[model samples]
Target: MSYGPLPKRIDPRKLAEREVRFESSVDVDQLPRLVECLALPDGKIEVDLQFSVDEQRIRTIVGSARGDLHMACQRCLEPVEVEVAATFNLAIAASEEAAKQLPRYYDPLIVEDEEIELLPVLEEELILSLPMVPYHQDCSIQTSFGDDAGAVDADGAESASEKPNPFSVLAKLKGQ
Candidate 1:
């Protein structure tokens, strides 16, 4: 979604408030890093946001938003549905010290005509909520190996067949 310019000057003396809702679609291919991790097929991003502005040292803003994205399974590389929801509070300060009093992660957003654009910040928050590991909760893939295998020779050692790199006496010698 596109947002208009924010108010150029926010008068600390006056209380400024605004509310907006936006909807937009983002191409999965545009997010190359996230796509590499998810390996998702072609998909779109859906977002819903509700935000308000209040006066603080400079101006304070708060918002709540939710998003839906399509992800790919880590195990079988299949499509999976993912959802994210978050609540945020932000402050725009005239000085660095005033900004520091607010949240460290708060970004300097646009303000115009006593209005602020929150869509960009909301999108970023949604991106941060993505899971480190994206996989289906109930994956359908199965392997032939089961849990019946027991320890080799009763010493709690793995079987020879299970060794990642098996040793061979003949192979150890350079020449025989």
Candidate 2:
């Protein structure tokens, strides 16, 4: 996949009667704002978009995007390879006003007489699909707190052999 400029324009009215296939890839750096949260690897997005335009509205956009990212694990704070695969459906209308009248979610991509670029929209969609707390399925650290590990219990009491809190005995004497 190659990261390039977006098309000057995509006439939904012209595509109303037909389907279009948009296959492209975009570099993460090209989207500076979105790169802040995404731990993007040196990779390009592989997108296979298939959709139709109905009059001035994009009816159904079904596609899949695959890419690799480097993100820190939420649990261990270690960097890990993240494989992203997202499938999405979007409706593009002429304007936000027109979309507001629609029942489903709609994104307004204005079409001028120039090339219409889908990179921005694609980036937004991908960002939304990202996991809030990303972690490896098999975490490296062990989390189980066994009794022999000297962990405190729910009642704020340590194991019998553990060091006693001096304040506890003081509190008991005061109670008497």
Candidate 3:
């Protein structure tokens, strides 16, 4: 389904009371923190959020955000497109003490005001979803030297086979 642009701020409590579901796209440029993790400033995050009061009377927001982000590949140091997706189950709390009381399954979202900045929340989710080390599946970079197992040294000794085994010393010590 077609989605509109996500609002910059929202009254999550009010939305939860009304049981609102937001389906929208957030611009990449608007999320500064998330942009810092990307190689290029391009792409939009598609988000689907549902706000409601659960059976326990806890106000919560459940949602998923997904997008393709351009990041430098760790293996090749080139731009690679990585798919970032995250799902959040957040329980709204008025204070730190209230947040501490939330169930373990729900992440606490502390808010003291009528409205909260929505982009930062979405940006944080996306940032957490990013891979620690972005790399291509089939990177073109080769990771081997000219060393061969059968090579001999200048003294006519098979260097590879003549290497001392550190474990052998341990075995000798164990025999004592």
Candidate 4:
């Protein structure tokens, strides 16, 4: 059965005991928080994760997710394909205090009332793993930061042409 964007929360302890491995993808459009940041929202995250119990009986999750995202290239101002991947080794925590006490090797994935919010949890990880400023590895883009930055209005009026640099005064105040 398809496993992702799971309709229900999973009991980590039981899954850990069973050694259940979930392989699935959640549609990007299905997650609003995730979709908003995407230039192209019709995509999916490939999830290949599993649950297991550690020697200390601590429930753990280990997995990686890979996917393609369309983000505006910081250098080109054009759509660029970004291959995003994130690997997580997490130990489930029973309480806020317990999360802090988790070992340095394993990040804590907080679980409350015996359940977890799977989508946002994973989405947050993937999102955090994304590059703060994404760009093409090799691209030919000529960007201009000079006077040509003048903007035009819908009626074809040159708004920035000879406009007394309104924000320029702010620079003067900084020295005072």
Best of the candidates, TM-score: 3
lDDT of each: 0.51, 0.63, 0.87, 0.79
* Poorest stretch of ten by lDDT in candidate 2: 1-10
lDDT head-to-head 1 vs 2, winner: 2
The per-residue C-alpha lDDT of model 2 at residue 16 equals: 38
Q: Candidate 4, TM-score vs. the true structure?
A: 0.75
What's model 2's TM-score?
A: 0.61
Candidate 1 stretches greater than 4 Å from native: 1-58, 103-118, 142-176
What's the ranking of the predictions by TM-score, best on top? 3, 4, 2, 1
Error of 1 at 58 (Å): 5.3
| lDDT per residue as tens, model 4, 149-172 | 666533335664655788889999
RMSD of candidate 2 to the true fold? Answer: 7.0
Candidate 2 structure quality by residue, lDDT tens digits, 11-116: 5445434776667776777755557766554667778777675564446566778788767787677876777777776665556675676555444444433334
Candidate 3: worst 10 consecutive residues by lDDT? 147-156
lDDT of 3 at 74: 78
- List the candidate 2 regions with Cα displacement exceeding 4 Å: 1-18, 54-60, 105-116, 142-176
Query: Which 10 consecutive residues of model 4 have the lowest summed lDDT?
Result: 151-160
Root-mean-square deviation (CA) per prediction: 9.6, 7.0, 6.2, 7.5
